[model samples]
Target: MIAWFRQHGRALAAAVAKVRAQPMTSALSALVIGIALALPAGGYALLSNLSGIAQRTSIEPQLSLFMSTEAKAAETEALGKRLRADPRLAAVRFVPRNEALAALRRTGALAEVFAALEHNPLPDAFVLRPRDAAPDALDALAGEYRRLPGIAHAQIDSDWARRLAALIRLARSGIFLLGALLGIGLVAVTFNTIRMQILTQREEIEVAKLLGATDGFIRRPFFYLGVVQGLAGSVVALSIVSLSLAVLDRAVQSLAATYDASFQLSHLAPADAAAVAALAGFLGWLGACLSVSIYLRQIEPS
Candidate 1:
């Protein structure tokens, strides 16, 4: 037990000392990893904000049900009542043809034309609010409403809403894929760096082998070296991510205040922050292992 403890103590001390000796180089490498990680994390934040907007728009979605020109007011009122009574309905608004025509005139641009018209050409319409009006739910409800006996046509109020939601989803996926590619770059960078370090120590490794050191004994230090690099890189990455978010949040909040919005943009939730750190560290560690394993085998210096 004493021998094992002494050997491990020496190895750890050496690895740590090596890092301390090259503070500038180590710091630069960590900063590089941090920058790479921050790009993806920022992209993800943009996606989250867009998603929130899309969700807010989807709430209380309504289907517009227009009646035929000859449809009676009683028929429209009855339809409104029936819609309100349905379990799937939230609220129903009835617009008479004359009231709809008046609304058009109030928009000001159509005032002259609306005055010239002899009859109210606008049809009676029902504005429907559904209980669950997410894109898919609204679509299904619109399909059912279009088939109703008295309804001339049922139209989804926000056709563009669904498209926006789809676009946001696509953007989010793209960001995630981009993050993955950047992570690969990080691993590549770390691996190359470790491989170079191993080659630099070839003479010392050969001397140890001549002294009857086993493969495990030589390999253990390189493994420890990888862990150090990975941990350092993670610390750097985390700092970058946090600092970038802090800067961005201030900018976003400033813009939001102009619009009188109660917007407080969120950062990476706890789970996501942990995931970012863990992923960065794991990649760093894996990169070191790959580099060390390949070169360690190439050096049969004994």
Candidate 2:
């Protein structure tokens, strides 16, 4: 095990030295890989943040069942029970006229306005959350609620939620497609890079073969080189994405504060970062394996 570790360590060092020997080319190639990776990675990060914002900002459409002003408290309770029993509803909350008025009074600006009223004019109401948030389901439930005997108004406040959900879904599909394309591009980039390295060291490879070195031994340095390049690119991509998110977070926070909102941007999670690094390394290793298999076959002991 120690001997194996020593051999691998020497190959890793040799790979580093080769990259150091052509600093400009290596840096340029890694930069290209990083940019290609950053596009999709950055998109994924933005989409995740957008999804979080949408979830926080998008208010669930609630069915407000305002009863007729003459309706009694017993009637409201009966209706509330029926609404709760329905399979379509997740919850039903009854708000008495007095309670609703008190809630309005809690708002500092509206407290004095509500206090000036001669009497409590607000009607008893029921706020409902549906089990299914789909637009069609909400519309159907709203119609049913409106037809109830004492229900003076049944309003569904969900148009924005529906539109936002659809937009997020469409955006997610687009991001997925973009990521797939960029992933293929990354693999191709690594493949071409490895191919060039193989060509450059063709004579050395032949000499190694003549010295009784196995193909595995000859391929070790290139594998290390590819993996190192991939990891380096991943680091660059992560840096660019994090900096962008930081800048955007500041802007988002400033805008949110203007509306008295407590919104904050989310950063990439640790698991996601790990996945990105693993993906890059795996793709690099795959590209190197493909190139090595092709070129090594062509360079025999002859």
Candidate 3:
């Protein structure tokens, strides 16, 4: 076991030496991979932030149950209790007629219009937040509520939620497609890079083969080199994403301030960042393996 580890350590050392040997080439290759990765990563981060903002800004499907003018207080009270007991509802709040009128008056533009009213024209209502936000679920709940004894009308403003949900779904699909394409590009980049390295060390590999070096021995250093490149690329990608988010957050904060709102772009979570790095490293290793397998066969000592 110790010998295995020692062999790998030596291979890793050689890989590092190769990377350091051509600093400019390594940096440029990393930069290309980083930029490619950042495109999808940035989109994912933006989508996440938008989804959070939607949640914070009341995107959940809501139903308003307005009482009939003739609905007795007792009947209204019973209906409220029933609604509160329903498992489908996340929350239920009863708004009295007078309280609703008072709220209308609180709105600056509507204040004068409401003040001229002889009596409260608004009906007592129950504002409901449904646990399920699916369009069908919302529609079913609205239908059920409208059938209740005291419910004069069941009005739901779930169109926005539906639209937002659809938009998010589409955006997520787009990001997934984009990421897939970029991932293929990333692999190609690594493949070509490893191919070049193999070409550069063709004579060395041939000599190693003639000296009775096993294929595994010949492959180890190149494998490690690919992993190193991938890891470096991931680091560059993370840095690009972080710096971009920082700049975007500054602009977003400024815009939000105009609306008296507070919002900031969030960076990729630690787990997500780690996953990116791992995936990058794996792609690199795969590319190197492919290059070595194909090219090394062609380099047998004559």
Candidate 4:
């Protein structure tokens, strides 16, 4: 046990010392990994916030059911009562023509224009809130409303929100593809870095082999070295991602406030952050293993 501990401890110390010796090279390699990782992390963060907005918009999706010009107040009231009684609907609010006109007048720019109109141009409308807010379900509900009595037209106010949700989903798939490609690049970079280190220590490796040192003994330090490099790179990547999110969150809050929306940007979940760090370290370790396997075989005590 003591011998095993001493040997492993020496390998770990050697690996750390080697990194300390070449801080610039180590940092630059880590920076490269960091940039590659940050692209996906940052994109995922943005997508998460957008998804939240989409969900809120979906849950409260409002359908505007406009009554026909000739529709009477009794028919409008009956339609409202009918919609309110539906099992699938959460709530329904009836907006009379006069109220609609009043709202138009409240808009500063359109107030004078609305005041000059001879007759109220707007028809009575019902603002609908559905119990189920799924896009397909909402569309189906809208279609049913259009066929109802006195409903001249039915339009969902959250159509843009549905589209936004779809776009965010598509963007997430694209980000995954891009992340896969970048992960390969990360592996390649680590592989080459390990290969170069192996070549530089060729003489020392040959001497160790001649002294009857096993392959595992020679490989330990390089393995440790790769892990260290990967961890350093992940630290840099996390820092960049965190800082970017901090800045973006502030900007998003300010923008949301302008529209009187209670929106806030979200950060990566704990599991996701851990996954990022784990993936980085795994890639580095795997790259080192591959390089060492190929190159170490070529330097056999010659």
Best model number under TM-score: 4
lDDT of 1 by residue, 1-302 (tens): 99888877777677677678778877777777778887887788767777888898963467899998877777777777788889988888888878999888886556888999998888889888888867788889888887876778888877688789879888888998999999898888788877777777888987888898877677666666666776677666666666777887898888877654556666767788777777877887788778877876777545
**For each candidate, what TM-score against the reference?**
0.71, 0.79, 0.76, 0.80
What C-alpha lDDT, on a 0 to 100 scale, does residue 84 get in candidate 2?
84
Clashes in model 4: which pairs? none
Candidates' C-alpha lDDT: 0.78, 0.83, 0.88, 0.85
Evaluation by lDDT, superior candidate among 1 and 2: 2
lDDT of 2 by residue, 167-209 (tens): 8889889888987887778778878998998889888888888
User: Native-vs-model 1 lDDT?
Assistant: 0.78
Clashes of each: 1, 0, 0, 0
Better of 1 and 4 by TM-score: 4
User: What TM-score does structure 2 among the candidates reach?
Assistant: 0.79
Q: What tens-digit string does per-residue lDDT give for candidate 4 at 40-152?
A: 87888888878877776763588889999899888988887788899898888888889999998987656778999999989999898888988799889999989988889
* Model 1, residue 112: C-alpha shift (Å): 23
TM-score, candidate number 1:
0.71
Winning candidate number (lDDT):
3
* Candidate rank order under TM-score: 4, 2, 3, 1
Greater lDDT among 2 and 4 belongs to 4
